[model samples]
Target: MKFTLAKPRIFFKVSRFLFPFIIVMGVLCFGTGLYTALVTSPPDYQQGDAMRIMYIHVPASWMALCVYSLLAILSLFILVWRHPLAEILAISAAPIGALFTLLSLVTGSLWGKPMWGTYWVWDARLTSVLVLLFLYVGYWALYKAYAHPAQGIRAASLLALIGAINLPIIKGSVNWWNTLHQPASITKLSTPSIHPSMLFPLGLMTAAYGFYFLLLLILRARTEFNKRKCLVQENFS
Candidate 1:
């Protein structure tokens, strides 16, 4: 079938085919990652057992940013193309992004308490992440505030667009400010500073989180699409 963003039903069918496969992959990745992270991988020289928290914290942080980036891109699509699926996808993604953002914050705090001796700090990285969480919530609120679909999405899309500015700030915060948060390890242009043993599990967990997000995104988008279709049918009837 020809894949097109304009056709939600076609997208739904494709997602249905991919769903079970994604679930299987996600489960395998999660199981293997957990075992490797908690059992096989050596603890950090500095942090010891506390370093295991990075397994969850880093992936959640990555996913939080990734999902919000997706949201911003979808918002742009909604504004420029005005595709029906764009609206469904944007609305579907907001809560998931928020969940990831919250997870990132919580896990970061858990990890930070041991190293930084504080649970929370108002530094650049942390503060920008908090702002990202608020942007996700704000987008959802704005989308729901309007009775008209077009108006609501337009307002929400604009917020998503404006909030896109924070993405860079969140990414660059550690470099820009003297935050307690460590600098990037895996994302550096040079070879990653992370040891191979730690990087292995981290990679697996990142894949697991990614697949899980895909499964959730497709399911949520499908549900939103069906709900809208039913509403339309009812109105016509």
Candidate 2:
């Protein structure tokens, strides 16, 4: 598996075979999750129907953090191990991470309007998450700003590593501060605070998001690899 991932051609070939399975599973999870989140799961006694937004908001927030963590690791590979595929994967994933961060913010605002009586707040958690979005955008912009791809990737990867400081802040903000955002219900060391009835759909939606991110990452990495191959050929020709 390590050998396969190190070689772009091998990785691309393996991903091609796995792509259809990812699509099928993602669709099934999304279909069933929407059914349960929108139809079956009981609404919060307090927040009412608006709480359904948690299905999207919570999972998107998770993925946004997960992807950036992945980016930070890939950056280490690019900077230290100098892995060839790491750069491609890093660039491919940055935009997807940004999209997930953006989705989380938008859905959280929509949910907040009814629950908090406002669409936006400068709470610690919200502000940290917003900083996360800016980090994602900054990494992407830094990658594109250079004339050489290698230079750009190294600069962007450094940014990714530095930005990792915010992940813990985002995760711990609710705990550390008197914030509007509720403390984590599902990720506690003890048993999750959430009810099993709602947890099922949240799990399903999280799986859906994971599969979708994998699908997009593989596709984008292949495209990046091919573009680099073409450039190399042109230089040699």
Candidate 3:
């Protein structure tokens, strides 16, 4: 009981401390990443200037999967410990994850057109990623379907847990099945396949996106907490 009630106070304090720092870092990282990606990064030997589209697509894809994994962990916290803060966090993060998922899909299509001569294919990786996007959408829709807040959160959390099985499949789909989508380049068993010139901007963009997600998560959680706080005050009064 003490632990559960203590959570919002703790999270609010942490959010206050970290919010400004992350906002500044996110802005700087994106500034550098954008400049480096568009200008300094060399054109691909095969795909030429068209490969530049990757800077946005790759980072967005990475964040999409990562955010869902985070949702799964939060689901565990809510289910196992019944943490109110965890419930707020999961709800706060769903829309952001869904946005990234959509960005990844759209960017992937843009990259695919020139390289694959088609905007999309029924490749394993692509199909699995689409499913992941649906999972995010489903969670968002299901959570809003209930008038009772607690019941909605429980249902959505359960869906998040069940959908997590798709994460590994999305990661491995290229390797497991012959697909037009390229195998892991920046992430592999050893050193990254991409050159340092491309890698640097890619790294910056990734950091920017990660911190941007953190900023959103903290702000959203705080807002949700404050709204609930207001509700409780009204109920008691």
User: Can you list the residue pairs that collide in candidate 3?
Assistant: none
Per-model TM-score versus the true fold: 0.96, 0.97, 0.96
| Tens-digit lDDT track of model 2 for 41-146 | 9998888888899999999999999999999999999999788988889999999999999999999998888788999999999999999999999998999999
lDDT of 2: 0.94
Candidate 2 Cα errors over 4 Å, as ranges: 1-4
Q: Candidate 3 at residue 71, lDDT?
A: 98
Off by over 4 Å in 1: 1-6
Question: 141 in model 1: Cα distance from truth in Å?
Answer: 0.9
The order of the candidates by lDDT, greatest first, is 2, 3, 1
For candidate 1, the 10 contiguous residues with the lowest summed lDDT are 1-10
List clash counts for every candidate, in order. 0, 0, 0
Which lDDT tens digits does candidate 3 get at residues 24-92? 999999999999999989999999999988999999999999999999999988988888889999999
After superposition, candidate 3 runs with Cα above 4 Å error: 1-6
Evaluate all candidate structures by whole-model CA lDDT and list the values in order: 0.91, 0.94, 0.93
Q: After superposition, how far is residue 19 of candidate 2 from its true place, in Å?
A: 1.1
Steric clash pairs (candidate 2): none
Evaluation by lDDT, superior candidate among 2 and 3: 2
91 Cα displacement, candidate 2 (Å): 0.7
